[model samples]
Target: MTSKITLFQHGTGAMIVPGLFDGTIDIQELLTHGDTGIGSGDGLDGESIINNGTPLLIRGDGSVTIADDHFTVPFVNAHFAAYSTINNIQINDFQSLGNYIFKHHQYQNILFSVKLHGQFEWVKTRSVFKQSKPYPSLVATAKSEKRFESQHLSGTVIAYYYPDAFSKFAVGGFHAHFISDDQSIGGHLMNFSGFNGDLGIQKFKKLDLELPIDNADYLNHDFKNDDIEAAINQAERES
Candidate 1:
């Protein structure tokens, strides 16, 4: 099995600074890299969830739809998932799911991509609106983010776990997105509970970074401030 994860554009920290919503890469090109992944749509319009090589969008109104062919992404992490094993597990909530993965996946230092397939008792998610020119910082956008929740849901959990060393690249801890089996609702997964699913795990041995060269805002922006990191953490965890 191949071991690699391809990242589109800059790290998450850099994105929070300039808040570049207009993506530099097209979805057609992004699909060439992997079959499963998560990202934000053009103008940060919606949550981008790629399953089976198809890009689906979860808009701010909690609406799930297919992305336009020409849509772009500023950031994304994807890979051809070749699972070592698919374990049937009973997870009561987000914390329990983490504990289970940690116990089963002993390699805490490598990158991990997971797919949880099954029924969920309840789930909560959030998605940010598209930002325009003179875009506010990610911290500001996060403050007025939209949130959605559901009960007795069935879907696939598209998630990734990155090591601490790569926290700036993406959230270091577990980050996930969900799209219901019926494709009606889902977003950046926040809290979930009562799930019985097949947990598919992929360990990546290599990482490929694709930086944005054309975006002048991203290229010349400063990402040295300490508050940026805190904002990212707060936005992801608390929003």
Candidate 2:
């Protein structure tokens, strides 16, 4: 019998609203949950992409390198299933990609993962600089994010979709990160064009969410008063 596919997520987008940027889970511990995933380093240092169990860190300046196992993350989404390629699609940009997925997959109420590999005419991405003590809200941190764009780039795009109902716990809609084949450019994907690539989709049957029970900031934050949806939209979706 085949094991059920599970999406292992550590921490939630809501934590960002309270400016909880400290690491709650270690990188080594996170890797035990899944092999392929996307996340950001402690204190929002950079974007991370775990390809085939190797975690690559993409810093604010768009530099990519292997992340140390001792490193930790404030947020992550990972899974162990090997992506099953569905088709070779012509992706004009991020919007078109979403439209295609919505029209074809139609799994609006469930969590799913997407992986795209091939050449892109151009790709635009952004990463946040590492924050220090007294971290600011995600909205504030995003204001200083470094943006990078490259032409004729070859790489992999890793993304996850959370239904609107899950917005309180995750960044609803599509949250994607990219890493170049050369491991030189990567970040939170902002925009892209001329994407001729193979698309792979994985639908998950379960979502295993791990909360930071011992984190005082997370436990004491006044989440009820904040408009989390708007904050997430501004920090994550609006580019």
What's the TM-score of every candidate structure? 0.92, 0.96
Please provide, for model 1 over 1-112, each residue's C-alpha lDDT reduced to its tens digit, 9 standing for 90 to 100: 2234443323354575457666877877777778788987767777888898788989878888887768887877777767665666788988887788888768688777
Q: In candidate 2, which residue pairs get closer than 3 Å at backbone N, Cα or C atoms, i.e. clash?
A: none
Give the Cα error of residue 102 in candidate 2, in Å. 1.9
Which of the numbered candidates is closest to the native, going by highest lDDT?
Answer: 2
lDDT of 1 at 84: 62
Candidate 2 is scored at a TM of: 0.96
Model 1 has a clash total of: 0
Whole-structure CA lDDT of model 1: 0.77
Across residues 44-102, which tens digit of lDDT does each residue of candidate 2 receive? Answer: 99999898888989998888889998999998998885677866678999899889888
Deviation in Å, model 2, residue 141 alpha carbon: 0.7
- Reference-based lDDT, each prediction: 0.77, 0.88
Looking at model 2, report the run of 10 residues with the lowest lDDT sum.
Answer: 1-10
